[model samples]
Target: MNAIELSHVSTAKPVLLGDSLTELEVMRDVSLSVPEGEILALIGPSGSGKSTLLRMINRMEDPTSGRIFLFGSDIANLDVKELRRRVGMVSQTPALLPGDVADNIAYGPNLRGEPCNPGDYLEHVGLERELLRRPASALSVGQQQRMCIARALANHPDVLLLDEPTSALDRTASRNIVELILRLNEKLGLTVIIVTHVMEHAQALATRVAMLVGGSLIEQGPAVDFFESPATETGRKFLRGELAEDGR
Candidate 1:
C-alpha cells in the first residue's frame, strides 16, 4: 500500500492583492508516491519548494490544485488533528516542549488521553532511558532531536516526515540520526519522507530520490541512478555540486 501520494499537486501563494491577485506558484505538477516502509529523500536548492511540499502533507499548507492522499484517504477530507497524528513531522531544528524529556515525548499521547513511556521510544532514537527526567533545554542538540523523534513516535504514526532533520547536527550526530531513521523504517515499517539539502546524507539514507526546483519536480528515481547518471542537465549540475542550494 502506498503510504502517501501527491497527484499533480500545485501550490500558489498570493504575492500581490488588488483588483487582480498575483500569485507565485511554489509547487506545480508535483506527483510522487511514497511506498509503505520506504524512505524517499527530497533534495533541491533553496526556494525550490522542498519545504513547501513537505508542509502540504499534513495540511500545514494546502495545494491550490491537485490532490494529496495519506494512506489511501484524501487528506483534505480527514480530520486535521487526526491527519497530523497519522502523519507526523519533525523539522530541521528540534522543537521540544518546555519541560523534561519524558514530558516532551508524552506530549502527543497526553493530548489524546493515551499513556506513553519515554523509555519505549528513547532506545529507538538512540537515547538513554535515564535521561528521561532531564530538562529538555539541558540536553545536547542531538539528544533534543531524538526527543523530538520520540515525541512524534508517541503518536503511533504510519508515516514520518522530516525536513532537514540533521542539518544542525555534528557529523557523528547526523550519522547516528541516519541510522536511527533506517532502524525505524525497518522495525516499525514507517514510511519516511525527508527533505534535505545535503546530498551525502540523502545518499546514505534514501532508497529513492526526488528533486524539485523552481517549484517543479525536475526528476525522481533510484538514488544511484539519479546521482550517477542524471537525465537532466539541471540534475547533473546538482549532483556534481556545481549548483549550490538556492540554485545560485
Candidate 2:
C-alpha cells in the first residue's frame, strides 16, 4: 500500500494589496504517491513549493482542493495529533527545546502520557548516551540535527518528512546525515520524503526522484533513470545547471 498519496492536490493563498486581492498559487494539481518503505527525494528550483508539499502530508498546511491519504486512509479523517504522530517532520535547522537533550527527546511521549528513554532514541540516531544529559544547545550543528531526528523518532513515527536536512552542514556532516538516513530506512523500514536542492545528495540517497518546477511536478522516476535521462525539457535544463541559480 502507498504510505502517502496526493490526488489532484492544489494550494493557493490570497494576497491583498490595498483594496485588491490576488490569489497566489503555491502548488497546482500535484498528484503523487510514496510507496511504503520508499525513500523519495523531492528536487526543485526555489519557489517550486517542495516544502509546502511536504507540509501538506502532515497537515501543517492544508490543500485548498483535493485530498491526501496516509496508508489508505484519508488524513483529513484522522485526529490532528494522531496524524502528526504518524508523520514526523524535521526542518533545515534544528528546533531543539531549551533544555538538556534528554528532555527534548522525551517531550513528545510525555505529552501523550507514555514512557520514553532518551538514550534509546539517541542510539537510534547514533548519538552517545552520555550526551543525553548535556544541554541541547551545546552540541555541534550536526549533532543537534541528529538529536532532532532522535526527538522525532521518540514519537514512533512511521514516516519522516525532511526539508533541506543537510543544507546547513559541511560536506563531511552532510555525508554523515545521508548515511544515517539510509541506515534508518534499511533498519526500520520507515517511509521517507526528503526535500533537497543538492543533486549529489539526492542521487546518493533517493531510490526514486521527483522534480518540480514552477509549482508543478515535471518529472518523476527511478533515481538512476531520471539522473541519466530526464523526460522533460525543464528537467534536462535543471540537470545541466541552466536552472541551478534558482535552486536553494
Candidate 3:
C-alpha cells in the first residue's frame, strides 16, 4: 500500500476573517501517492502551498475538501493524536522547549508512559551523550535541529515529514542532516517525505520529485527523468531557474 495518498485534496481559509470572509484557496485538487520506504521530495516556489500540503498528511490542518489516506486508512476517521504519532514531523525552525536536550527528546514518549532514555536517542540522531543535560538554547542550530528529529522519533513513527530541515544550517551541517536522513531511510526502512527548495539536495536524496507550483502539483516522476526532461512546462522552467513564483 502507498504510505500516504492525497486524493483531490484542497485547502481554503478566510482571507479576511471578520469583515470580508473571502475564501483564499491555498491548495487546489492536490493528488499524489508516496510509496512505502520511498524518499519523495516535494519542491515548489513560495506561496505554492508545499508546507500546507505536508501539514495535511499529519493532519496539522484538515483539508477543506477531498480525502487523505495513510496506508490505505482514511486520516479523517483516525484519531488526530494517533495520526500525528504515526507521521512524525521535523520543522524548518525547530522549537526547543524550556529545558535540556533530554527533556525535549523524552516529551512524546513520556506522554505515552513509555520509558525514554535520552542517551540512546541522542546517539540515534548522531549527538553525543554528554550534551544530554545541556541547555537547549546553548546548543548550536544544527544540534538543536537534531534534537528535534530525535524528539519526533520518540513517537516511533512509520513516516517522517521534514520541511526545509537543512535550510538554516551551514553547508557541513546541512550535509550531516542529509546523510543522516538517507541512513535512517536505508537502515530502518522509514518512509520520508521531505520538502526542500534546494534542487541539488533533492536530487541527491530523493528517488522521485514532485513539483508543486501555484498550489497545484504540476508534475512528479523519477528524479532523473523529472530533472532531465520534466513533463510539464512549469517544471521545465523551474529546473532552469525560471519558475514564476519567488522565495525558496
Candidate 4:
C-alpha cells in the first residue's frame, strides 16, 4: 500500500494586485503515490515546482485543489503540528539554534514530549557523543548537517524530507551524508523523499525517480527506467547535459 498519495493535486498562484490578476500555475493536475519503506528522489529545474510539491506534502503549503492522503487518512484534515512532527524536514542550510549540540538535538523530542537523549541520537548519526557539549554553531558545515539529521531522528518520525541535504558539503562529506541516510533507512524503516538538483546524487540514492519540468512530472518510475529510458524529451535533454545550464 502507498504510504502517501496525491490525487489530482493542483496548486495555483494567488492574485496579487487585482481580483482578476492571474499568476503562473505552479503544479497542474499532478497525481502520484509513494510506497512505504522506500526513498523517492525528486529532480527538476528551478521553477519546476519540486520544492512546492514537497512543501505541500508536509502541509507547509496547502494545495489549491484536490486531496492528499497519508496512509489512509486525509492529510488536509490532520492536525498541522502533529503531521509536521511525523514528517521531518532538513534543508540545505542547516538551521541550528543558538545552543549546544545537545540542545539542538533535543529540541524536537522535547516539543513532542518525548525523552530528549542526545547521546544515543548523535551516535546513531555517526557523531561522537562528546560533541554534544559544543555549541551548535561551532560545528563545521558537514557536522552541522549531521546534527540536523540527528535532531530530526530524535522525533522518531516515520518520514523524512531532505532538500538538497548535501548541497553545501564537500565530496567526502556528501558521500558520508548519503551513506548515513541509507543506514538510517535500513535501521528505522523510514520513508524518505529527497529533492536534489544533482543528478549523480539522485542516481546513487533513489529507489524511484520522479523528474519534473515546467511544474509537471515528465517521467516517474523505477530509478533505472528513469535514468535509462526517460519518457519525455525534456528528461532526455536533462540526462544528456543539454539542460544543465538552467539555474536549478
- Model 4 C-alpha lDDT per residue in residues 21-110, reported as the tens digit of each score: 777688888888789888899988777888888899889999889898888789888999888888888988999887899999999878
Candidates in order have lDDT scores of 0.90, 0.91, 0.90, 0.87
Pairs that collide in candidate 3 are: none
Writing each residue's lDDT as its tens digit, candidate 1 over 1-248 gives 88999999998998765677788888889999888888999988888999999899989999999999987999999999999999999999998788899999998899989988878898888888999999999999999998899999999999999999999899999989999999999999999999987788888888889999888899888888887898898898998879765565
| Candidate 3 stretches greater than 4 Å from native | 17-19, 246-248
**128-169 in candidate 2: lDDT tens per residue?**
999999999999999999999999899999999999999888
Error (Å) of candidate 1 at residue 97 is 1.1
- Greater TM-score among 1 and 2 belongs to 2
Give per-model TM-scores. Answer: 0.94, 0.95, 0.96, 0.93
Worst 10 residues of 4 by lDDT: 239-248
Give lDDT tens digits, candidate 3, residues 66-104. Answer: 999999999999999999999999999978887899999
Candidate 2 backbone overlaps, count: 0
Candidate 3, residue 167: Cα displacement in angstroms equals: 1.3
The order of the candidates by TM-score, greatest first, is 3, 2, 1, 4
